[model samples]
Target: MFHQPNSEFAVVCRFQGLFPDDIGGYEKHRTRNGGDLGHVDASRSHLNRRVIGNADWAARTIAMIEDMKAENFADEIETLTRRRRKKQLKHRMVEGPRDPWRATRHGPMREVILTANRNWFDAPATSAARAARAQAFEDAARDWLLANFGEDVVHARADLDEQAFHIHAVIVPKVQVELNGTTRWMLQPSKHDLIKNYEAAQDSVGQHFAPLGLARGERRAAAVRKARQTGDEPPAYRQHVRTADWRKAEDTKIVETRAELEQRAEAMIVDEIVLAQREAGMIARENAIEVREQAAAGRERAAETKEQEADAMLAVGQGLAAGAFDIEDRDGTPALVETPEAKPGLLSKLRARMALSSSGRARALHVFSKALARLRKQSRDEAKTAVARDTAEIEAADEKIVEIASRLPDAERRSIGKIRLSLSARIMALTGRNMARETPERGGNDGRP
Candidate 1:
């Protein structure tokens, strides 16, 4: 699923070291009990004006995920991000073969990085699992980017630090590169069109004014035919044209109407792209939650075991000392003497007496059971919370997709004027992956593959 980014977000792929750190780094603290904490600037670093008008799906999704992890919890489980305010979670900026932060001090160095950074308060609980998942994710992302963009991606790295997890991609050339005769992008390159310049360039986009060798209306007719058959809107490539109106539009009414239509069309195109991106992210979040649930279940069990052991020791101690359980005993209690039942063994009588007098044998067992139950409840609660959060995020992703597609095309999309809701639906399917779940199709979507 495409990551749901706040309106505060902007896509930042060509980050030249300075931009990313400036926008979204962990806040630094002074001392143990310092003054106000410092935070990273989140202002637009894209250096593009039009992108400011629209938003990028992936960047927004990543931003939301990180912010969610950084929130504070008053009761129950607390995230490390909360424990130490202003201190950004540990981010691994280590340089390695696949690391994105590689340096070329002198000569000439240029590379691409598809990096991701987000804090997860609880890592030890599912470190192994996350690591495994990340490994697989990296491999898949690498292949996916290469396939979508180009094959010039020389290096790819995906890993996690204790506080925040991230991915790094290093490509030799720029994202939009000259491949053979055409151009290609890396890491959701189509998304690159979301850049400010690209959006502006599209504002006045039009054909070369001269008619092509082929029939002018053929493609447009095909688009109309598809729309009629499927009962859906026309695709982005074929839009409503002004063959008749443009010829005689000197009145203010015609001019105003044309301008309004153009703006609406651009808005629609932007919305559709964003919508698809979000749905893809939704599917991915659900999967992450399920994995978290299993991990939480395991931790809950371990914690319960420890609490039980503590109870057992406390119980036996209390029993021996007549409800005065002294933990710091010089020598642990030995069984006391009672009636010699048939004199089965030398210590049988003593063991029996101790067991009878302590009154703890039974009570201790009960205490252990109670402790286990409490811990189990805590663990289950944590799992439920995780699932709840995951559900909300996933649902939001779905909604965002709908809202984006529902928008009418505007001037920003002058050339195509409008993007097909169907195209966005198709791409949103693969956004956040290896995750699961389905949401209601917004508007009047059929929800087909």
Candidate 2:
């Protein structure tokens, strides 16, 4: 029941007026207790009355009417006096009626009551949330009145004590009239000009409450008007009314047999299966494209890693070559021999002279041996670290290449296989060179004699 469209249950009433006596009676019913049908309901009534432009109901209603009448009288008198002066200046007779305000009666005060059907508020049962929504609806309605009528709405109230929650807004109809070349406020007899069309008022109300789940009710009059304008026949449903008994009887009949229902279900299933298959194929193609992209990226990363490893290996080799020296003869034949210097530096001469003392020479040799041993150990550790780093990088590159090959298509896989073979050969060559460098005997007489 709550899921049904609210447009069918929405309500917006037209502006209706009340005379002075009627206003007095309504005030009595609202402010005081009288009967069960009165405005007050002791069992279910809640009143949130407010005065918008006056101190109380009397000032807003009866007193406001008297003040407007007095203003109208003064305006009429001013108009007459101006006309008499104009006639005298033109030398024409001013013989119109002297008492324009004598029998003029101020019209009834207009009020529009907006409320929805009872089922709307009662559907969720009586709860704090439901009450809050009802209050919000009333506030929205009041805002609508203030926006459309501005200061004309003198008083407004929301009465929740009745069967259906509703809002009552009293509007004082006043318009500006020109009197003796000066504009003055005068009481309007009716709100006909203000509310020229019922449809527009309904639309305004709908717009104000639309956010609160209140939709504009379907206007049959508008549909009829449209039909006449377009020269089309009115819908048959509008002319026909189905009785409750007939509707109930029709609902009781079985619409489809079990066999037919099964056939319809099977057809629906087949349609769904076809749609699912198409969607699955599209998904597969998209996934294939994504996998290919991932594989390509993996291959690029692996190639970059391989290049980094090669650069590291080259740097290590250069560092080792710079630290070590190759001794060769004048004819370019490898040799190792000592050559005497022409003179000794001051520090070397002092050290040679001190060698005659046994303790000094022993201490100097001991320090030199320790220093050399430290240098050799540091170099070996650095070389081992560099080799380990390169090995890790090469392994990572191989893993990436393998992963890419696994995901690639058959044709692409063959191309990757060839690249893998080339990379494996390069790796083997680098490993063999490193092994030969580590084992001096394996290098033979290449650089040493």
Candidate 3:
């Protein structure tokens, strides 16, 4: 009923202890809590299908080993004890009751792990195809066990619940012994020595599966011979690493690596934000410096203009002091002359002095008015600049708040949004106050000149 296995596939046959004392925990794990193991996916446990064998490993062991022992060996043991008593009475010899099938040295059961190459079954993914492959393997393995070990194979189970489909066959090692006028089967693991003849067992199983293209693994003897030829020691047999432990370690590494990556990413983000803030601060400082330079240049220009006006007023006063009028003959008529060197008459001097005083007062008054206007304009410009800078900073803060709020939970985001709105309102009020204060109507500066 089994399909031909791919030639590339190989079979695995491992023998290990499955003692009577270990059966309770083993049965619970295999039957009930298999999903709790690392290799098993609890969510896909529904896909796990049992091929054969009952859940009561303990009962099965008792029935096959202890019960059989009591049934067949009880009378023989009693008779042997009676004989031993008579022998002890006749001779000075140490005699004890015969317990031939005692299980003191070795347990009654040993487990065999049987499976084809894992890839053969796992390659096919579709439900029907995968099921067929699993069924074929199970059937072949079951038949092989029955043919090779007979009734000694007390329990056979195929587990499709782990990483791969495999079969566990429980075998009781026993042999027929002829002694003390009776023939009986007795527990004798040392005589059978299945674990000692592991290579032979693998070879036998491999031969059975040869028609299906399954091949045996390399022999230890062959490996030893090869090692001798190469002038090296024979390789030591290594124990199988548990799939659960391997997977757990790998998962832990993956989690740790992922967490490290996340932390690095967060750190990078924070660094970029800090850099951007620093750049913004630099830009603001540069802008303020430019504004101050511009205001200073304006003040310098105003000072130069005032100096020139003062010089012009002084020149007028000097001309008025020199003379008010100059007399010169032109076409035989008398003409008044105004010059720096011309001497003034008493009446002319009086007129010039009165005129100079009146002009001086007006010029001084005009200069004072112009200076006041310039000062007022400078103050207004400074106030406007301050208001603009504050407004820009407030807007920037609002934008930052919005960006941060976007990452928060809905409730927290809503609360932050309310705060942002209040901040915006306050900013608006501040802007209004700045604007009102800067206005001429607020009496900050009136352009009287």
Candidate 4:
């Protein structure tokens, strides 16, 4: 018999950046604290174990990584400190860049989460095979991480108390770079380059777990490519959804919408100005051409008096060449030489500018269309969610009502049924939906059906 692929037990590998100051906070969260942590089950907290290093060990490991071919950035650090102090003196809140040591967008320490589905780790207390499977998977994952990241994997831990069984490893991507004829250490995550090409990293993780019969999850790149081909937005994965992240995305969208409206208004004004300038240029060109013709006519009359008919005819011919011809003296004779087709006029220039603006508007329209489609999809999804929640709540309330009614005396139950019928009638009247009438068989043990 053919068995289905264990796609649900696919390997998950993700990398996140953390600043120097955030490392201690992560340690506190991963380790034990005395207070009641909402998500944690304190009874099973003892089961949580450190697979590798602790906070002190991680700090020391980072120091070692920094010491290897390290570059002195004391001046830069001092300057940053002075700036912070100055801001503090002014009572202004200072927001530091992601990487304070260098001009990088990501922090130095990388947080690597390695895990599979929750179902893979779940097992009964006496099920030796299932328990062994969980242990084996964790062992393989930890070994694979250490082998791949080597010394960069500073801290690794397993938190079994949470909803899932996963290993968290801190990787400090400190690579040696040859700068100015010297090998210097730099906090560069590109040395691993997992964040940029996470799909490939996921593939690698999946291959490592192949012996355990676990496949890889859906590749994000594939989904993105398919979406692009279809002119549709890629589906959002549940794992990537966080409340703060969602809010940030919403705020960004609002800002972008405002910016787009401003741009459209600016474009409209530009088009109006360009059109006015074009119209003015056309009128000016017409006037100039008319005057040139009048001047040519007057010159023709003078040529007739002086009997220079050839020059007169030539002047008329040149004037009709749409302002392209110019008269020049060639060997003591006046001859027409075509000037390089006359430079494009102000009208032509304005037309060209308007063409560019039209293209920009077209692009903006395309973006607006995409945003509209996304909003429509979001509205539909939210409506479905709301309906589901309402239905579940109503069903739960109905069950409670039936339980309460069953405990009541026969007289009281009959009275309650009358009240329920009146309430249902009122609700149906307001909603314009017909409410089903109760039959004798459907009614309780009372003569009120």
Best by TM-score: 3
Per-residue lDDT over 221-271 for candidate 2, one digit per residue giving the tens place of the 0 to 100 score: 778888989999865544322224444455445333433554567778857
lDDT of 3 by residue, 1-449 (tens): 34465568888887766566567666666666533476765676575555445656558765455434433433453344446654432221111112246555446457878887677777776878878877777778888877777777767777776778888877777777776676666766556544558777878888877765678766777788899999999989766665667787898899677656655677778577668768987997999999899989988996766555444444333332344322233454322335444445644544444354453334533322232334356667778888888889988988999999999999999999998898799878979887776755312122111
Q: In model 1, which regions exceed 4 Å deviation?
A: 1-14, 17-110, 115-117, 120-124, 159-163, 174-449
Positional deviation of 411 in candidate 1, in angstroms? 98
The local distance difference test score of each candidate is 0.35, 0.57, 0.62, 0.58
Best by lDDT: 3
Q: How accurate is candidate 4 locally (lDDT)?
A: 0.58
Q: After superposition, how far is residue 103 of candidate 4 from its true place, in Å?
A: 2.9
After superposition, the stretches of candidate 2 with alpha carbons farther than 4 Å from their true spots are 1-5, 32-40, 46-48, 51-55, 78-108, 179-184, 189-194, 230-449
TM-score of each: 0.18, 0.43, 0.48, 0.44
**How many residue pairs in model 3 have overlapping backbones?**
4
By TM-score, is 1 or 2 better?
2
Q: Write the per-residue lDDT of candidate 4 for residues 118-155, one digit (tens) a residue.
A: 77666335567666776777788788887777777778
Deviation from native of the Cα of residue 267 in model 4, angstroms: 59
lDDT of 1 by residue, 1-449 (tens): 12222222211132222222222221121111222222212232121111111134224433432222212111112222234432322210011001122243321112333323232212225766555544443544455446533533433443232223333443232333443333333222223331223333222121110111111123345666789899998766633333134334445577566656655677787577558657966876988898799879978986766455444434343332231221121133222222223234533433443344343344343232332233345555655576567667666866675566457365543323234345445545643331232221112122121
